[model samples]
Target: MSAIEVLAPGLLTTVQDLGREGFGPMGVSPSGAADPLALRMGNRLVGNAEGAATLEMTLLGGTFLFREGGIGALTGSDFGANLDGTAVPRWASFEVKPGQTLRLGPTRSGARCYLCVQGGIAVKSFLGSASTHLLSGLGGHEGRALRKGDVLKIGDAREAKEKGTDHNASSTEGAHKSNRLRSVAAKALELLAPRKVLRVTPGPQSDWFPKAAQRIFYSSTYRVSEEANRMGLRLAGPAIREGAHGEMISEGVSLGAIQVAAGGLPILLFVEQQTTGGYAKMANVISADFSSLGQLRPRDEIRFELVNFESARKLFIEQEKLLAAKDLIV
Candidate 1:
C-alpha cells in the first residue's frame, strides 16, 4: 500500500468526503468537506469516484511527501501549489513521482482547497463515512487535524487504470486537451467574491421574529465574524428585533439554517452544525449557494436576497447540471 508522509499539517487539514448522512439523529453532524463541490471536482479530475476521500485544506496549505508515484489534483482555492519546486496549475490533474514533495502555501483567494489522490485516502470509517467530525472526535484519522509525522494510507493507483483511459497522465498532455473546459469551470468557481449576495428562503420559524428583524436581515450587509468556523458562520450586523416571545423549544437544524442567537446576530449553520439548535431561525440559505458560503473567510461581507422555494429549486438544478456536465471532465 502507498502512503503520504505529512511534512507539515496546514491550518486545519482533514480527510473528508460527501459527509456522513442518516447519522444526524445520533447527534453526529454531517461532518465533511466544507466545499463538497470542490472535493467532487478534484476527485473527478483524478478519475476517482465523486465521494472519494480527499484532503481538505483550510486557509493555509501544508507540505507532503509521496512515498509512491500516483496521480493527484487540487481544486477550490489556489494556494500557490508546487510539486518538487515546479509550479502546478489548479483544477487539473497531474502525476506524482515516488519521493517527490508537494507543497502548498497560503491561499490567495478562497478559504479552502481540496487535494484528491487517484485512489482516495484509505481511512477507517465511522457511521459509514470517512469524514472527520472535529466536535465529536468521530471518523477519519482519529477524528482530528493531521499532525506532523502522520502517515496516511492511500489506495492503489493501478486500480484506476482498469477504467479505460489513464486520467493521471502528465500535466502537459492533460492540460493541452482539457484546458479550455477547465478554464470555464475554474472561472465559475472564482466568481465567489469577497463580498457576496446569497439567496435565501423563509425558515420554519420565520414568523417568530418581528417584521423589523426580517427587514434588517434582508437589507443589511453582515460581516463574517472572526469567530466563524466549520460549524457555523457568525455574522456581525444590525441587531435583529426579536418578538416578545423570543424563547422557543429546541428544534432540528439543517444545513444553511440562519439562526438568530440571543445577541440578535445571525449564525449560518453549516456542515458541522449540531443536530438541534435552540436559536430562532429566521431564514435558510438556498442549497444552490452552499458552495458560496463554504468559501467565505472571516471579515468578508455578505448580503441576503429573498427567493421563493420554486426559484431555489430551479437554481439548485442548474448548479447540479453545471457540475455534472461531461464536457467539464477530460
Candidate 2:
C-alpha cells in the first residue's frame, strides 16, 4: 500500500479532520484542524472529501518521502514548501512521484498549514473522527503529533479516480497560474496579516462586564500571548474589569468564546477548548472569522469589532460559497 514515511516531524504536526462532533456531551472537546477552511480546501484541491484527514503543521513544517506516486496539496500558510528541493506553490495541488521527498521550512506568514494527499490519510478513527485530541490522547495516529520514522498509510487513490475527482486528471500546476487562481491565493494570503480585526458578538455572560470594560475591549489592541495554544489564545491588552458580579457558575463554552480570567485578561477559546469554562465571557467571535484565529502568531495584534447576528450570518454564507467554488482550486 502507498504511504508517507516521515523523515522529520515538524513542530506539532497531527492528523485532523472536521473534528469529533456529537461527543461534547461526554466532555470531549471537538478537536480538529485549527483552520478547518484550509484543511477542506487542501482536500478539495486533491479531489478528496472536504473533511478528509490531513496533516496539520504548526509554525514549522517537516520532511516526508512518498512511497507511491500521488497528488498532494498544501494550503493555509506558506511554509516555503519544496518537492525534491524544487520550490512548490501554496494553495495549489501538484503531482508527487514515488521516492520523491517533500520538505517544508519554517512558516513565512501564517501560523499553521495543512497538507492533503489524494484519498486522505488512512488512520484509525476515534469517535468517528481522525482528529488528534492531544489533551485526551484519543484519536489520530496514536493520538499525538507525528514522530520521525512513522509511516502513514494513504487511502485508495483509485477510488477518487473512479469517482471522476482525481486531481491528476486536470493539471493543477498549469491552471493554478491563471489570474483567477491568483485572486484566490491573494485572499488566502491576506488572512495571515500581522494585525487583524475580528468581528464578534456579545456573549451569554456579556452583562458580567461593565460598559467601560466592553468599550475597552472593542477599542484596545491586544497582542497574542506566547502562552497561546490550540486550547485557547491568551491576549495581553487593556484589563477588562468585571462589574458587581465577578465570578459565575461554570457553564458550557463554545469555540471563540472570549473568557476573562481572574487577572482580567481575556482568553479566546479555540478548537481544543474545554467544554465548560468558569470565567465570564464578554464576547464570542463570529463564525465567519473563527478560522482566521488559526493563523494568528505570537505577538500578533488583534482588535475586535462588534457585528450583529444577521451580518455575521451573511458573511458565513458568503464564505461557504467561496469554499464551494470548484474553479477556485485550479
Query: lDDT score of model 1?
Result: 0.80
Q: State residue 286's C-alpha deviation in candidate 2, in Å.
A: 0.9
What would you estimate as the lDDT of candidate 2?
0.81
Task: Kindly list the per-residue Cα lDDT of model 1 for residues 210-260, writing each as its tens digit.
Answer: 788788888999999987788999999998866424567988988999988
TM-score of each: 0.90, 0.90
Query: Listing every candidate in turn, what is its Cα RMSD in Å to the true structure after a full C-alpha superposition?
Result: 4.5, 4.4
Error in Å for residue 46 of model 1? 0.1
Off by over 4 Å in 1: 158-195, 244-246
